[model samples]
Target chain A: MKGRLLPLYVVALYAFLHLPLLILCAFSFNSSRFTVWEGFSLVWYRMMWNDGALAEATWNSLLIAAVSTVLSTIVGTLCAYGLWKKNSKLLSGSLYLSLVTPEIITGIALLATFQWAFRYLQIQLGMHTVILAHVAFSIAYVVLVVMARLRTADPALEEAALDLGATEWQAFRLVTLPMLKPGIAAAALLAFTVSFDDYVITSLVAGVDSETLPMMLYAMARRGANPVVSAISTVIFVGLGMLIVASERLQKA
Target chain B: MKRLRALFLLPAWAFTLLLFLGPMLIIVAYSFQSKGIYGGVVEPWTLENYTRLFDPLYGVILLRSFVMAGAATAGCIVLAFPLALYIARSGTRKSLLLNLVMLPFWTSFLVRTYAWMFLLRDTGLLNSALLALGLIAEPLPLLYNDWAVIVGLIYGYLPFAVLPLYSNLERLDKSLFEAAADLGAKPWEAILHVILPLTAPGMRAAGVLVFIPCLGAYLTPDLLGGGKSMMIGNLVQNQFTSARDWPFGSALSLALMAIVMLLLWALLRRDGEELL
Candidate 1:
């Protein structure tokens, strides 16, 4: 009885989880504007494709995610290695602070920081400011993920390379870098996803011209239900789902 | 070699210090200052912003945020516990079950929230299906309310609650249960004394994970509650955006942080170190 009931419960839970997404995808193909069933159609998808603002937002999101991923991955991997070499309580504690801090708090704080800097620098709150904010919060995640990976790595591997007449840099480059590749990749993916999905912080720090996908989606959703929004959501859902699956495969490899 | 490694750490440290810590410190300073006539901060310090937090309007918003967040957390716990237990007990399908739980989380949060809006709106799928079934004469007022906000919150954070509880339960010692059985304790008593105490840490972690974000959630209430309900997060955003009251916003942000810090401190005190 328990065994039979368990699978039923699991199925029910998963149904609850995925039903909304599935419904959204289904409605995007419905010809009618309302939620009632209509004949199949691709009109909403075409409308979404034609949306210039959304196209711009997607481009901005991709660019920001890409730049921030590269920056955070490099800085974070190095920092993780440093922390591994010498565990500093203060450094680790500060990393924890970034992880635990609410998005709104981080958003406002970064917004204020940018505004303060812009006063003297004469720079605007555009893609650059958004990138900087993305890099700031994203580094913590990369550091944590890489640090966890580093803990599992053998310190002797690097020491062995060192004793084999290789220079310190060569030992790190050849041995430690290869070992940390999986971790670095995972961190990059995490940073990318986070940067891509972020709304609160991006909305606060982003200039009017630098809106990201989430920002656009929020704006559209606030206005009202549009079938085009559903179409865009389906694209995002499929795209992100593929990315996650690919990353999971990479981690396993 | 040690010096070289430390050198590698400098960039990250400098970035975080200049950007993360420095901005947070700026917020702290801004919180103490007065709001300028135009928008930004002014020189002379005052606790006026914090005092304004206690006013009835803001107080009601704050109280409503807590109530909604608390309700969502409670709902997640109740729903997640059984699901997590089932996943943990499933011998062969555990990883698959866990993955299913997490799959939705990987999607964009705003997208997910929007999906919920589509479901709960008056002409939404839920209402349509119910109407077709003759469950009601008219569409029920599902969206643009506190309950709708709670549903969105719970939907977003339920996985956070589940994953932790599943992990803790997965690691539970079956031998302990066997021992309890041999001692002739009732099943309920065994669960109460053995299982519950062991899973307390995960429960606490789940509570923290769910509650903190829920307390600061803005998108759910804004989209699902149809602006009828306002939370602390919405209030803070308004201060920064529409209201253009930076000092007041900073003060509110600091207040939220203080509450989070207090919760963390309490958890640290209870757990005596590592928090998940």
Candidate 2:
């Protein structure tokens, strides 16, 4: 009886976890906007497709995520290599601050800095500022992932490459870079997702023209139940879900 | 060789120093300054912003945030401990179970929170299903309250609690339990004496992870609590956005950071080597 009850408990917990998401997905198909179902239809999905502001927000989000991911992955990979070679405890410890600091605090700090700088440089708060904020936080994750990968990697492989008449740069390019590919990929994916999904920081730093998908979703949700939110959410859910699955497979490979 | 390595580190360290550390310093400075009559900051620093935090209204908000966060952390611990233990003990299907726990974790946070709004709203599926089953006479008021906010917080943070606990539990030596049994200790006694003490670090880490985020949570309370329940995060957000009080916001942000830093310092003191 105890053994059977254990599985039942686990099953109930999983049900609790997944039921809300499944319900949201299911209701997105309801023709009626209310929770009470009318007939199944794609009207909400079509409405999301026709939302011009949302489309712009989605584009901005993709742009910021893409830029921040690339920049952070490169800088962070180098930083990881530097930390591994240098073993700088202070530098490594400081990275944890970004991870632990609350998002609201981080957002305001960045906003204050940007406003301070813009006073001198005359630059406006827009996509550039948003990308900068994303990269600032994202580098922490990338460094962490890469550093973990570096720890298990055999340092002697690079030494061997150096002994074989390869330049230091060549050795890294030929040996370390190849080995770190999975970590870099994982880091890039993580940075992208984080930048893409961020709301609080983005909302605070984003100007009128630089709205992202999360910002749009917040505004819509704040107004009331819009079936378009359900439609857009389903799309994001499926897309990111696939990305995570693919990344997991890649890590295993 | 050392110089070359330093060159590689320059870009990242410089970026962090200029952007991350630089902004944080500005926030500290802002917290000291006086709020301008027309938004933003003014010269001639004062402690007024920090002092303003002691006002009864703000005091209540801070207290409420801590209570909510504490409750959520406790709830997560209760829900996550059993599940973590089950997965740790399970054979062959461990990865699958872990993945199941993580799938929703990786989904968009805003999207998941919005899903809860749909589920707990008065006319939501939960109420309708119960009504259809003749289990209720009318729709229940499930959303726009403290319970809704707590549910959302737990749902969002459960995986964070689970992951740390699972990692710690999975690493425990099975022989320890067997040894306790050999000594004629009961199962509950073994759990209390051996397992709980051993897993305390994981529990602490989980609590910190869930509690810190819950304390700073804005979206959950704003959306689920229908803007009625004001947490510290919402207060800071309002000070900057709608309240147009930058110095006050900076002070609040600093206060929030101080609490987080204190917790982190405690964590570091307890588990000095593992956090990094």
Q: Write the per-residue lDDT of candidate 1 for residues A1-253, one digit (tens) a residue.
A: 5557766877787898999999899989999998887799999988888888889899999999999999999999999988898877777777788888888888889988898999988889999999999998999999987887788889999889889999878987898889888878978887898889999899989997798999888888888868998998999888887776665555555
Give, for candidate 2 chain A, the lowest lDDT window spanning 10 residues.
Answer: A244-253
Worst 10 residues of 2 chain B by lDDT: B267-276
The complex in candidate 1 yields a DockQ of 0.72
For candidate 1, the iRMS in Å is 1.4
lDDT of each: 0.87, 0.88
* TM-scores, one per candidate: 0.95, 0.96
Q: List the residue pairs that clash in candidate 2.
A: none
Error of 2 at B64 (Å): 0.6
Best model number under TM-score: 2
User: Compared with the true structure, what per-residue lDDT tens digits does model 2 show for residues B1-276?
Assistant: 587679888888887887888888898898899878888889888999999999998999999999999999999998998899899999899988998899888879999999998888877778888888899998898998888999999999999899989989998999999999899998778889999999998999999989999998988998999888889999999998888888899999889988888998898799766644
Q: Per-prediction TM-score, chain A only?
A: 0.94, 0.96
Off by over 4 Å in 2: B133-138, B182-186, B274-276
Q: Which candidate achieves the best lDDT against the true structure?
A: 2
